[model samples]
Target: MQLSGLAPGDWVTVQARFTPQAAFLVAADGRTRTYAEGEQRITRLARALRQLGIGRGDRVALLAVDSPEYVEVLLACMKLGATYVALNFRLSPAEIRTVLAASGAQVIFHSARYQEIVDGCRLRDAIQFESGYEEFLAGGPDGGELPAVTNDDDILSISFTSGTTGTPKGVLQSQRMIKAITQSGVLELGLRPGDLIYSGAPLFHAAGFGHVLYGVARGGASVIMPQWDADLALSWLGSGRVRHATLVPSMIIQLLEHPELAEADFSGLRSIMYGGAPMPTSVVRRMADVFGCDLHNGFGAGTEAGGQLVLRPEDHRRALAGDEWLLGTIGRPAFGCDVRLLDPDGAEVPDGAVGVIASRGDTVMSGYLDRPDLTARAVRDGWFVAGDLAWKDQEGFLHLAGRADEMIIRGGENVYPVEIEDVLGGHAAVAEIAVVGEPDPHWGQVVTAVVALRDGHGTPSAAEVKEHCRGRLASYKVPQRIVVVANFPRNPAGKIDKLRLRELLAEGRIS
Candidate 1:
C-alpha cells in the first residue's frame, strides 16, 4: 500500500506493470506514440510541470483533446503528486472556467488551436505544446539539476463529475484508484494484452483516464480519436483487425447511422464496453446490428469507488432476446464490487424498490477532492452512495431508473423523467434528448424535454411530439413542454447540460 510521504513530482516511480515498448497510442496527427515514447514524454513533462510551480496536491488543469499529450500530462502530474484536472476542449471557455474554478487548478495547458483562448485566461502560466513545452522543461524546476523520483499522496487526479442533478463535484482518484479500476475492468471487461482499444470519449473524464491505465496495465494499443467523429470511427472499425473500444450511447447512434457501416466490418472487435450516459433502448438494438462484436454495457461513474456494474455481452444479448426490459438495465455489479440499493435513511430497500444506488469495493474513489462534507454525504457506513436511483430484480439485474433528484414529483406522483424520455428517445427524429423538471403551478413541477433534432431532419412540432409521447406515456409523465433546438449544451463529458437547461427553461426561453 502507498502510505504517506509519497511525492508525485520529484523522486516519483511508476513502474507500470505494462511495458513501454507497446504501441500505447495513435495520436490525432497520425503519429504512433509508443509506451516508451509516452514514458519519455511524461518524464520531460514532469520537468515542465515542476517548472510551472506545480507541487504535490496542487491542481493543474489539462485542457486538451484525446491526444498523446493528454496522457503525457496525466503521467507528469501523477509523478509530481499534483492533482490534474482534465477539461473538455469542447466546452465553452465559461464552462471550462466553471471546472477550473471548481478544481482550483493552479496551472493550465492547451493545444496550439486553443492558444488564443488560454492566452486570454488569468492563469499563472498557460503553456503550449512542443517548442513552448520543451523550453519550459529546459528551465530548471525548484528541484534544480536532474529530475529526482519521489512519492507523496498519490492523489494524482481530481476528476470532475457533473452528476445529473447537481453542480459538478471533483471525484478524487489516487494513482491506486486508477490502477484498481483498470485491473478489474481489464479482467471483467476482458481487455487483453496486445488488444487494440478504440477510445472516443474526451480525455477529461474518468472513463478516459481508465483507458490510459488499462492500456498501460496490459501493454495494449490505444486507437485515439482526438474528437469523437462517427465517420472516422467507422473507418477505423472497417479496417478489420482484433480490437476493443469504449463509447457512450450517442456515439453508437452515429456509427449506426453511417452509410458505410452496414457493409463495414465489426468482426475485428473482440470486446466493446460502454457506460457514461444512459443507453437508449433503440440504440442498444442498433448496436447489435452494426457492431457484431462482444458488446457490453458498463454502468459506472467517478464516484462510489469508480467502476460499479457490467452487463456482460452474452448476458446483454441473452437478456435482450429473452426480455427487452434488460435493454434499459445497467446490468449487475462488476467483479469484486459490492452493490446495493439504499433509501435516504441509509437502509437497504427491497429488491424491486428504487433507491439511491450504493457500492463498496476496491474500485471506489478516495473521496471528493478537498471537500469533507461532500465526501461524508457520498460515503456512509462504508458504502459509497451514488445519487442515482435504481432497482434490482429478483434475479439480481440492476435497472438504473435515473438520478434521485431527477425523479419528478408531479401532482404528488413520483416519476422518473428518464422513463418518459427513454420512451421518446426511440423516435427517429430525436438525435439528442434531455428531460428536466420545469415550473408548473398545478403539478408543482412538470417534466420537460429539450431535444436536438437529427441533421437535415425536420423537427416535429411540440404538439406532435407530445401526441407521440401521449400514445406511449401516461398523461402525467408526458413532457409538459418541448424545446426544439440546434444543439443541447453539454458538459466536458458530453452528458446533457440539464443544469443550464433548467436555467433556459426558467427564463421563458422555451415553452
Candidate 2:
C-alpha cells in the first residue's frame, strides 16, 4: 500500500503485475491504455531512448500537448534513469530553443503540430510524435529488461517556473518529491483503485501533470483533456464517466456560464479538486448547488515545491452555510507538509500578522537546476520560501496577502492586491479582477485595478468600482484607478499575466 520507496516507473510496474487489466490512461481522443499495455509501451520507449544514446542522468525533452505519449515519455525516462524535461508548447521557438539549451537536452520529442518549431532548433535528435513515435517504439522490443533507477534523490524531471515574475528557472523534481506529492494527492483527494480522474491541466505543469501520475500511483485511470473546453468537459462529467475531476477557477466559471449547464448531470462525481487561483464566493456557491460534491481548494507551492495546503470539502460546506470567511483562506497545511508564516527575520509571525509563507517537506524540489546560488536563497535550512506572503488566523487557517514582489507600496503603505481584488471582485459587474501599482511621483506607486465585467452586465465606472471597495477595504487599499478590459492576457498556465499588464501599462497600451 505504501508508495514512498518506489520509483516512478515502479508505480506502473506494480500495477501491471497486480492489475494488468485495469485502465491506466484514457486520452482525450478516446484512446485507452491498460496497465499491461502501458508497461510494455514504456519499456519499448525506454529502449528507443537508449538507442538514441540516452542513459542515466541524460536529459530528454518533450514538447507536446496532453496525450498518452506524454506519460509514456516521462515513465520511460524514469525507467532509463534519465531526466525528463517537459517543454511548454506555448513558448515560441526562440524560447523553446533557449530552454532546451539550458537543460542540455540530448533529444527532443515533439508532436507533428510543432514539427517546424523542432526542425528549426539545433538538437542532437528530434522525434515527431505523429510520424516518428511509432517508428521510435520499434527501435526497442515490446517488453524487455530496463535500466533500474536506484537513487530516490536522483532527478527524475525538471519543471520550469512560469516566467510571470521573470525568466523561468528549472526546478529539479526528484523521485522523492514526485512520490511525496503523489502520495499526498492520493490521500487528500481520496483517490481509489480503478477510479476515473479527469483534469484539464496541461501535462507540462507540475501541478497539472501530477494528476496524470496520480492515476498511476493509485492504480486508476486519468481522463486526459488535450485542451480546456467547457462544453466537452460538461458532457464528460454529465455522462457519469469520471469519478473525480481537477479544474481551475476559470474553468469552473466557464462551466457555470455554459448554456447547457442546467442539463448537465454531476451527481456521478465523488469530488472536485480545484486550485491554481482563488474562486469567487458566488461561483463556489453556484458550483456547489450544481455539482453537489466535495470542493477541495488546493493552494500554495510553486514549481520549486509541491502542494502546501488544501481547503478541504468540510471547510467549503461550513463556508457555504455560515462561516463565509473560511472561503477566503487557503485552509490548513496539507498532509506531510510543514507550513510556516515567517517574518523578515525568519521567525514565525503572530496570528493575523502578515509574513512570508515557508514550507518544509518531502514534496519540495531538490533544487533549481544549475543555480546553486538561487537555490540556496530559495531553500534555507530545508524550508522553501518563494516570497508568497500570507498570515495565519487564530483558527490556524492561512490567508493569502500577495507575493512579496507583487505587493504594492503606495504612499509608504504596503498594499496586498489579493485583499483589494477579493473586495472589488464581489461587485455585481466584476467577473475578473487584478490589482497592480502604477508609478506615481506623488505616492511612489498608485494602486490601479484592471477588471473584466460579467456578461449581460453594464460597465461599472471607475468611480463606481472604487466606491465598491471604499467601505470594504481600508482607505489606502482602495484602487486609485480602475480600468475595464474586455479580457486580460494570461500565461500558459491560465493565470492573469500581471507582468505583461505592467509592460502594457508602461508602454501606454493598457491605459
Best by lDDT: 2
What does candidate 1 score in Cα RMSD to the true structure?
Answer: 4.3
**TM-score of every prediction relative to native:** 0.85, 0.97
Query: The CA-based lDDT of model 2 is what?
Result: 0.85
Model 2: residue 130 alpha-carbon error in angstroms: 0.5
lDDT of each: 0.72, 0.85
Colliding pairs, model 2: none
Tens digit of per-residue lDDT, candidate 2, span 1-511: 5886667777888888899999998876668889999888898888888878889999999999878887889889998889999988888788888888899887988888888888877789988888888888988865554546647889988888878888889999888888888889999999889989888778898766798788888899987777777877998888777889988777887888889988888878999988776577777888899998999998867467888999999999999999998988888999889999999999999998999999999999899889999999999999999998999988899999989998999999999998888777788887888899999999999888888878988777867866776768888888878787887888777778898998888898877
Give the lDDT of residue 464 in candidate 1. Answer: 75
Q: How much RMSD separates candidate 2 from the native structure? A: 1.5
Cα error, candidate 1, residue 339 (Å) = 1.5
lDDT of 1 by residue, 157-220 (tens): 7777654456667887766566567667778767766677776776777777677666666667
Give candidate 1 misplaced runs (Cα > 4 Å).
1-20, 47-55, 90-105, 116-125, 137-153, 163-167, 427-431, 450-475, 480-483
